[model samples]
Target: MNKLLAGKRLLITGAARGLGLDFAQAACAAGAQVVMADILDELVEQEAGALVEQGFDAVAVRLDLADPESIKAVAAFSAARFGEVDGLVNCGAIATGIGGPDMCELEIDTWDRVMTVNVRGTWLMSRAMVPHLAASTAGKIVNIASDTALWGAPRLMAYVASKGAVISMSRSMARELGAQNICVNTVCPGLTLVEATAYVPRERHEHYINGRAIQREQMPEDVTGSVLYLLSDLASFVTGQTLAVNGGFVCN
Candidate 1:
């Protein structure tokens, strides 16, 4: 609501629900024009419409991160809808039903799917948006990662590996994009209560609750401030860093 992102245009993926939706709403409240995308086209449209009803500059687009061309199309569509994107939040990922399998038990097909959507998708999305970001003075990219990779959480091999790849890839991207003045960073959230996390084991949630320094359930909004700050000029000089917004569940 501070209007810090008043004139900025942003695109967020996996925005049909959960953290991605939270990011879109927060960015819109801060006066940003947002393009919310997801594989769930109807649900995403509904969410975006709710924002529009609130007088926010927002629209929904269908995006299948698993498809390379779909990723490129969304980037172009975003620019056409608003303008050259000033910020991008890679929040779309495959988390549901991905856990409970050890790495040895994790099927190769499932591993490939997770990589396609989470790792490659993040990379391809950033690549597709580089041109638009280069045109902006304060372009920013915030990739959503998970703390599971930090503490080596078990029974979620594919998800953890994909997130670890994101963190590593983000560092390299920051160095590469620095020449264009575009900051690329990662945000690692702990087990949070969200649509995607509905399938998480209750014991896992309890573990996070008891282990976190804050000793409470983490919410989607808990991580928004970090994402917003990374998108804002306040973090213009900050890049290639991973901020764990997990209330000390996994301290870096």
Candidate 2:
């Protein structure tokens, strides 16, 4: 309810559920007009409609992060609808198919798929929307990364690599886009149990819970507050920082 993002137009990818869903809700509650998108078209539409019915300024679109064309279309649609985009939250990611075609013998196709969605997808989305974001005096980009990249998690080499690339990419983007006043940063979420994480072994989940300064499972909302701040005027002078909102899971 800070309203720091009031009158801002935000585009959040993978915004149908989990952390992305919480992000859209928080941004809308803070008075931001949001365009929430996901590859899961039905889920995105349903979530957006639900928010709109609740009197939020939000809309949904089908955005396949892996596809360049999809990124362009969403950018165009957002520009047409909002006139300008003030913020972007890249929350879409892929972390699956691990353990015969698994880590030790990971499939090339699957590895490429992960890179395509997690790395190339982030680049494509940012590239497509940079022009719109540049128009705003306080444009911002927040890419959701992972702690696995911080401490390499076994059996998920590809995922860790892609996320690490995201962190590095954010820093470089900040340097390049700083002149335009567009701040780019990365948010590293640690062991948040969402539907997408159901595939993770229970032991792995326990590992994160046990390692945190706050000994509890992190919910989607746990990551929203920092995200909102990153996209708000409060963080106007902040850029190229990797903020780990994991209850001090791995302190720097």
Best by TM-score: 1
Residue pairs with backbone atoms closer than 3 Å in model 1 (clashes) = none
Per-residue lDDT of candidate 2, residues 15-78 (tens digit): 9988898899999999999999899999999999999999999999999988899999999999
Runs of candidate 2 with Cα error greater than 4 angstroms are 97-102
Judge candidate 2 at residue 61 and give its lDDT.
94
Candidate 1 local Cα displacement, residue 219, angstroms:
0.8
Top lDDT model: 1
Work out the TM-score per prediction.
0.98, 0.96
State each model's C-alpha RMSD to the native.
Answer: 1.0, 1.4
For model 1, state the Cα shift of residue 185 in Å. 0.5
What is the alpha-carbon lDDT for the whole of candidate 1?
0.92
